[model samples]
Target: MSEHAAVDQEASNARRGRGASGGAAARRAARSGGGPGTQLTYIKRKINVYEVLDEEGLALIE
Candidate 1:
């Protein structure tokens, strides 16, 4: 690939690693739903917002 393509690919990959996906995975335990005792009854193991708690160490001011 050209130098520009290589740089773009690398930057994209790095962004993904440090972007929302990474955060989601790291905080999956808190955001995931479909666990036992939760309101979700369709899927016991399904991950949803209900199971997520606002404890990602980062929050919006507004």
Candidate 2:
């Protein structure tokens, strides 16, 4: 293959890992209502809000 084609192939492997198979496991989890628990979930795992627990009194989470 051409140099550009070889480089593109390597980049794609790096992006998706060598044998990821296009996220079949994740799709199965979503379809069957199966997945890790809330704390283990990554969809909402990022801490976006910086709430003050001492001033807000923990009610913001509840």
Candidate 3:
């Protein structure tokens, strides 16, 4: 039981750290004049293929 509890705590801490790191990294990415989420760039290049593709696949569309 103690071993299991320790393992659980470790896992939780790891998850929290990972989440925090990811958020920080995302913020950094958004801050360096680059962001679809950071309210900095008007044009976010991270749009996926489907969003970039047009209905017919010929004309460029937003």
Q: TM-scores of all models?
A: 0.30, 0.29, 0.29
lDDT of 2 by residue, 1-62 (tens): 69999999989888876474548787787788785556644565656777557656766767
Cα misplacement distance, residue 40 of candidate 1 (Å): 18
- Judged by lDDT, which candidate is best? 2
Collision count for each candidate, in order: 3, 0, 0
State the local distance difference test value for candidate 2: 0.73
**Every candidate's lDDT:** 0.64, 0.73, 0.70
Candidate 3, after superposition: displacement of residue 28 in Å? 10
Sorting all predicted structures by lDDT, with the top scorer first, yields 2, 3, 1
lDDT of 3 at 52: 52
Give the per-residue lDDT digits (tens) of candidate 3, residues 1-62.
99999999999988786564457668788678564454454765775564655577655443
Candidate 3 runs further than 4 Å off = 18-62
Where model 1 places Cα greater than 4 Å from the true spot, the runs are: 19-26, 29-33, 37-62
Ranking by TM-score: 1, 2, 3
